[model samples]
Target: MKIGLYFGTFNPVHIGHLILANHMAEHSDLDQIWMVVTPHNPHKNKSTLLDDFHRLHMVHLATEDFAKIKPSDIEFKLAQPNYTVNTLVHLEEKYAHHTFSLLMGEDNLKSLHKWKNYDVILQNHDIYVYPRLEAKGPNREAISSEQENVALKNHPKIHLIDAPVVEISSTFIRNNIKEGKNIRPLVPAKVWEYLDHNLFYKK
Candidate 1:
């Protein structure tokens, strides 16, 4: 079984997320895409982030109808500042039969070198990158070159996929909700209800 690990904060899971995951699963050879909800990301600010359990629950709601997509809270118990390489190691130990791959945007590729033990990740894991329209050309080129570099030694099985870039970000949705604006179609219905009931994203 091939699983694409789609890691994110997912403060509130949105449609854009579902679209990208679905596109990757439908277009690529991946059998399933798991939404690995991070408890805390070292790179991102936690000020506006919802609780980890809340975020994970929202993701579970948002992806409930989709059989190929499911939510994971594996990072919750891993300690503060969840790291990808560590998660991969844990997953490998827990699910030895599953082949894991990294699914991320092209922008993340620019900073892949900065990640903890990135070389080990590159040598052992495959990465699936989806193009982002908002990223600078240099970033895209860098991602392409990085893929090529990995391809040369057959090191990190990197693949660049063409998933539609719908710019509906959770940040934008949070901002809209903060301003008391309509966020009807931005997120899934179940997520909306959860957010509304919990008053999440309100400053």
Candidate 2:
């Protein structure tokens, strides 16, 4: 099986995530899209993240109806401060028959060189990148070619996909929920129901 790993915190899976994953599965050569729920990311502040189980369940709810997409808790058993390269290696060892590729936004591509063993990752797996609209904010830092590893952009293993630009983010939904605003439309029906019933992110 040709699987595409779409890794994220998914504090609360939103419609944007589902749309992108569906697009990748339908439009790309991948046979399946595994939404890998990270238990702990080295680059993120873990304090703000929801419980790993809760986030994974939300992803399950969001992708239940999608035939080609499914939630993955593979990272939960891995060591803390999980790195992509480590996970890829583990997956390869466990599922030798299944080929794995990476699905990421263009913005993440800019910083791919900074990831642990990025060279090894590039050499072993293909990368499918989707477009991301520039975030407009005072805190946003502009990325220049000078700051990026230009070789990565032109790597033979890199594939630039024409997926839709989804601006919705988990942080946005979480903030809205904290403000007592309805984020029903931003997430799947089942996910919204779960969040509402549990009063998640309302604190």
Candidate 3:
């Protein structure tokens, strides 16, 4: 099986995340897209993050209806400050029958150099980079601009995907909920219901 691993904190799984995963699963060669819920992202602020179990449950609720998408808690079992490279290594050793690829956005590609053992990741696995809208627009220029860096530019392992840009984000949904605004349009119906019943992000 060819699986695409989408790593995120998922503080709360929203429609935008589902849309991207669905698009990748359907349009690309990947057989499935696993939303790896990171308990604590080393690079992100942890103060505002919801509990790990709560975040993982929300992901399950959001993706339950989708056959191609799965909610993963693999990172929860791993060490703190979960690194992508480590997770990939573990997954490969545990599930030798499956081939895994990294799924990310153009923004992540631009900052790939900062990741732990980033060169090893690029050398070992395929990376599917989806479009992300920037201030100037879609960040498709990174692929070409990085050509001077022989390691990443035109790398066969990096595949740029033209996935549709969804402007929605978890921050937007959380803020809307905190302010008592309807977030039905921003998240999956079940997720919205879960958030409402659980009173998440309410002031």
Candidate with the greatest lDDT versus the true structure:
2
Can you write out model 2's per-residue Cα lDDT over 1-203, one digit (the tens) per residue? 99999999898889899899999999999999999998865566776688888999999888888999989999988988778999999999999999999998777887888889898999999999887787223222454352244576578998989898888999999999999998989999999999999988889
Task: List model 1 lDDT by residue over 107-193, tens digit each.
Answer: 777678778998889889889888787564656566667655645323436787878989888889999999999998889999999
lDDT of 3: 0.86
Full-model lDDT for every candidate: 0.85, 0.87, 0.86
Assess candidate 2 and give its TM-score to the true structure: 0.91
How well does candidate 3 match the true structure in TM-score terms?
Answer: 0.92
Off by more than 4 A, model 1: 41-45, 136-156
lDDT of 1: 0.85
TM-score of each prediction: 0.89, 0.91, 0.92
Estimate, for each residue in 74-189, the C-alpha lDDT of model 3 and write its tens digit: 98888776678999999999899999999988776877888899989998899998877772254456554653354675789999888989898888888888898888988888
* Alpha-carbon runs more than 4 Å astray in model 2: 41-45, 135-149
Candidate 3 residue spans exceeding 4 A from truth: 41-45, 135-143
